[model samples]
Target chain A: MKKKFNLPVRQLATVGAFALFLLLGNFLMAKKIIGLYYTKVLMVAAINMILAVSLNIATGFLGQLPLGSAGFMAVGAYTSAIIMRKVTFVSPALAFPVCIIIGGLAAALCGFIIGLPALRLKGDYIAIITLGFAEIIRIVILNIDSALGITLTYGASNLKNIPKTTTFTNAFIWVFIVCYLVSALMKSRHGRAILSIRDNEIAAESCGINLTYYKTMAFIVYAFFTGIGGALYAGYLGILNPSGFSFAKSIDILVMVVLGGMGSMTGSVISAAVLTIVPEILHAFSDYRMIVYSLLLIVVMIFRPAGLMGNKEFSMDMLTGLFKKKAKGERSKK
Target chain B: MSTFSLIIKQIINGLQLGSIFALVAVGYSMVYGIIRLLNFAHCDIIMVGAYIAWFFMTNFANMPIIAVVASILGCTLLGVTIEKVAYKPLRSSPRISLLITAIGISYLLENTAQLVLGAAAKKVPGFFTAETIRIGQVTVSTASLVTIAVLAVSMVLLTLLVQKTKLGRAMRAVSEDAETAQLMGTNINGTISFTFAVGSALAGIGSVLYCCAYPQVSPTMGSMLGLKAFVAAVLGGIGSIPGAMIGGFMIGLTEVFVSAIGLSTWKDAVVFLILIIILLVKPSGILGKTVSEKV
Candidate 1:
């Protein structure tokens, strides 16, 4: 008898691919093959991937249309930025991780509070409330200092000069970890329950799934990672403005999810990369970029509502299936 | 101004703003009632309407009435076309897809405006003379009077159209149940197009009023305005016409009062905070029907 390698192929591939990506990134950076502009694009794509994947939990898995991903990001960005700014005694490496946690927790708390009352409503109502919440968040950030007599948030003006802690390596690592955790969570029993709710709410309820509990849980998870992405974004920019996290920003992330396939994590990653990079490559169309992007959204939604992937997960089985078909073809030729 | 006059003036201001919001909210609630869409682009239609009015008044005809009518007609055509093109194809798709399309359409309109007219805010030429009418210590601008008058007339005419006419019945039937309405020989497509036209017309009227008061038009103006009007629709209980009117008024009042209390910067926040509280306390809204999902 021969012993065989039976370790999870998907997990192994993910680790291998991520390691390879990091190595390639380092090589490119070291050799100056990757310029500042390209590196910035890659980092932004990583942040968007994190956003799209986390939003998939709520919009894709849980079947909720929350148009407030940017609000959570804003909370994370501001909280983490404030922490990094105020906590000058800590090392950048130590402070960076702590700020991510703090920012994520703050956004999670906001999600819990918002979802408590909001998730009760059905359909478009939730979208409206979430949008309003995002705007309200912006407005509060704009006027909070004046209202509270505190100098925090700086009141609508851009909060500038924070440490730049988000390197390509760490961003890639964070995105990898988030994607791994999200995929794992989606594979668990809890993920199935959430998927059931998305498929059929009444039937899901009859099966004894706690609708409110699961809904809020998914939302909080979505907010938590959105916050982390925002924290990463803040560090990447070293300055923050509430305007950057406007309703348009939320729509930007939503477009990626919708274009990628709401329920497919791999779809989100692909679309996020394509959408982010395509715009940069076509710099001449910068003015028409939004127009074209929006036109694509309407066309895609009209033609392929399930998105480019249509709820299909990318798996190692796909690769093996292709190989097996090729092998059979070779055998027939022989 | 004395505190009493100042308070009175703010009330007038609130009413003027509320009427415009109510007009926009009416379109929002009507479209939602018929198609079950939030119609994110509805407010952008208002932006288009404003620009059309600006173009007509500045370039074609300087007459305010011509500008107003042209704007309304332009929006009606644009709204109907958008429905036919972007939304109609996705009619059978999931609600989320339609919502995303609406957002896309909104982005398209905003970007087009940005590309064509530039992102800088354009000062809209005054459509009416600024005349002040005094009632005791409180003075009200003619714009406020005209806005209230327009809102009143539109509301009455809309109520009559919705309650008494054959097309209105068809609209009601489609909104209630499209399949059943189609089964009963209602022109579902026509009614939907009509709904869009009426809603867009109202948005056009709202835009004129908004420009009268604010006097500035920009590509991004519709977003905040649309969001607030949607809040008004939600607050009034979506799918209910009269509810939208009350919701709009409440939002306007809240915004004005917030500013009156020297929290002008927080006015937008206050409006949203009120919406959240209303949702938490009564998610169905002040005038919206409580929908019971059948298990």
Candidate 2:
């Protein structure tokens, strides 16, 4: 019988290295040498990571191509912002957690509503419905404030003046927490069910899996994180606009998921970081950036149809094995 | 205007708008029927067609008919080329891959048009001006009548092509089952290209009619119209040509009615609301047939 594997010393070093890099980034931002501009960019990247990974759960893991992530995010953003704006007496520290949870719940509720009918549909139909739902949500939000006679100031102009709560530290911490939580979830029993469904819903059902229950669970959970991500985004940007969460934004998030290996947590993180940073670096080609981005996606799909990472996970096995060999050699020398 | 006259005016407006949608929806429905891929680029094709017409009309103003003919032919050729280049190679790829490619093509076309044409909206020359006809207290613009007539002729021609021609038969055969049609000696590539050509040619006509009625053109104009036409196609039953025609009118009338009822802000929302409700109630769409897969 095979024994359980242990993490290698080298794999531990990589994680330690990444953690240190994040720490250094935070330190630099706090010290003011790197400038707040880059820090803001990093925050955007963190929010995008949260969105892309959460969406990967549904589209990549659950095998449902939901184009309504933007709609759900919009719901979460507006709900959290309204809560934060109305409950102004609460401490910012206390409100932060409340906002994230509220955002998540609002998004999950929207997801439940959208998913009830949408989960039953498949492929292009799901995509179209979700796309329509997002547009409807945008339009509804545009008219919502006016309908209530509240002067509906939050469409193209953006929702302003809630609180500036997100900092480099908070955003970095949230990024780590989200990445770890999503990765752990994906390694769990529920994660296995998601993968099974993605492989073949019919076969998975034949294996006695309740397709609707599990699929809805994934959908809800995905919506929850996406909502939190939206909250983080609203807080970081200090403004919320309907235009900010358009179909184009949804497409951008989808690009990250697609570019990252769809089912790979590591792939999501890397792609999110790269896609977020690459455009800023190519600022010289402002007009051509999207054109290049679109072409890159097309080329990548043509060359690597499975995506950049293709369901592979980060493993400590090889690193641990090498570390063990090195330890043995050192002991022999002693 | 009298209430009855107002109603007639609105109905005529709806018909004019619906016919444009029907033109674009036919391309969307045909492409979706054959490949099951919602060619997101189809919208941009309409934009390109409008731009082509604009370029010809602005530069070669002396020969207006030749310019119109050239724009339609240019757009048709462009559509066929896109199919040959981007779509055909990815035929066997996953739906998501093809979807991304369609989006890529869409962005490529839109951005290219923006770079070439500039971001500002352009004014297209009016095909007819200073002419109105009145009937029973209702006055209709000449352009509106022309739009209705052009759409009617386009529909009739499309119906004949789909129902009567040998190529149309081949298109139907391939759409039903590509491999089976190939086995039956149909040139799959040729049929698909022809489908794109016909669909794009119609888009060209739609663009001319749209520019005439609206009198404005922009690179991004096709995005909203394309999405609306897609909704219309789905409403009428995707893959059914007659269904697209009916769906187009329904969407146009609904939009007008929503705006007329003092819910101007909710016009876009109403269109989508209708789509969601339809999809929830009838997954195959209004006129679409459900095809069960044999395991």
Candidate 3:
């Protein structure tokens, strides 16, 4: 009778709310109700959200453990930063997006190269190989200038003078785009192929999914957006150095992905926000914070290994279902 | 020094480093073989061992024998306790959880050590006396000689223990199939605990040797060393004992050579590059078995 108050309208409503929230956040910043400190935290949370979600595609969906998110991020950051520095004629507005894309592409190229050979190995080996690659990437960035006799990358020293272009509005926008693409990817036929591979590699291969192709594809997508996140990270900080993208940095991102439920985009968003802010809130226990945080990780895995959200996503329907108690019936869909 | 002599010295240097890597890597390989975990805490155990040694050496003022025994025993106990407390419950869970838990434990050890010991490195002088034995064209430190000798003795003892003992057989059975081993009345828990003990003991020995070479103990020292040793484990073929040893030597020599060529800064990169290349060429590692997944 009411034309079935359907999917498209619900999608439109969610989209509108998302935009409205963004506008509210910007307005609050403008009004100084969200201070500079809080705004910085929000920006960092946005960056980490991009990192965790993009990492989930490769780690969560592809079921591969790669310790090289920071490597790709470093590549993207340096690539875009260097290019931005090189191009003097263009306006900041025009050059920023192009550089971000180029940075992403460069990182994707690295992922493809590393993943092609690395995906051949099984679980722990892939993790080790990726860690090696990340370390090598950092060292290369650290020494590329002095070894090759070029002024690029500036070696171990920090690369400075890049314009800061990552505003809160733009970074959160990128986060939404990355989350959308990743989720859409999971729902696509190809995403099915990727997930199936993760669920059981041999079964998928027997069913005729080219194991290498799908694996590398997911990894490339991961590296590409991680690169973009890194690019934004680059613009956010306006400086770059190999020291900034160490193995520990990659571990930090992994901690976020693992702390949030792997394979859950909404979980990544929540954990990223919570993790970024809570550390600041507990600033008094800065030294002991890692100890507590690590203990929390152990407890979470022991009691609930599925992480804070498990594999469940935070859907709009779930929110409505909480109010109406019909989400389960709706989710069954039969 | 002549070119030949310099090369000889570098070879000695490589072997010294290689011996330490092999010592550390044995722990990683053994743990991975039995438990199928990366055991990020294995490296941190070595760090704890170093600190214990530092504690003994600094507080007791030069009781090297007491320091060595206490450090090794401390690492062994810590390793077994970590397995009991942190990893036992997750034995049946997904491997990723175990891995994250291991990492969490590693962070716990490091941060605790940092908070307690302070982040700055406490320099502990070399355990070996500064005795240089010069042969026809080469001069060798007694520490290097002792390192290689200890590695050799440990490897022999380990191989013997794994090959000729009941516990070793139980370890092999559990690694092959835990359910089958338990069905056959193997004490799976005891065997796993024993494995952790042995591995941590190796880490303890490694830390002692490392303290000799580097003469310093810091909270973060073990992270990179542990990573390199794990790579060594992978390079030789994960889950293979001799593979770990060979991988360690290769990595050790690679680092020495890279540094020798005036690319000291790039040595870490070179070690990782060698690992990547080796894995690309031989996916299972030099001595690793190629396991095919059964559908």
DockQ of candidate model 1 = 0.78
Better of 1 and 3 by TM-score: 1
Residue lDDT tens for model 2, B193-268: 9999999998888887787778778988988899899999999999999899999999988888778879988888
Error of 3 at A307 (Å): 1.3
What are the lDDT scores of the predictions, listed in order? 0.89, 0.83, 0.88
* Candidate 3 chain B least-lDDT 10 residues: B124-133
Best by TM-score: 1
- Candidate 1 interface RMSD to the true structure: 1.1
lDDT of 1 by residue, A1-334 (tens): 3233455865687799889989999899889999988999999999999999998889989888999998999999999999999888878877898899899999999999998888877777778778888888888888788888998998668898888999999988999989989988988999898999999988998999999989988999999999999999999999888888888899889989988998999999999999999899989889998898799889989888889898998767666676778998999999
lDDT of 3 by residue, B140-219 (tens): 88878888899989999999999899998998889888889999999999999999999999999999999887889999
Candidate 3 per-residue lDDT, tens place, A161-239, comes to: 9988888888888888888888888889999999899888889999999999999999999999999999999988988
Ranking of predictions according to lDDT: 1, 3, 2
Candidate 2, residue A55: the lDDT equals 89
Cα RMSD for candidates in order: 2.1, 3.4, 2.8
- Candidate 1 stretches with Cα past 4 Å from truth are A1-9, A329-334, B60-62
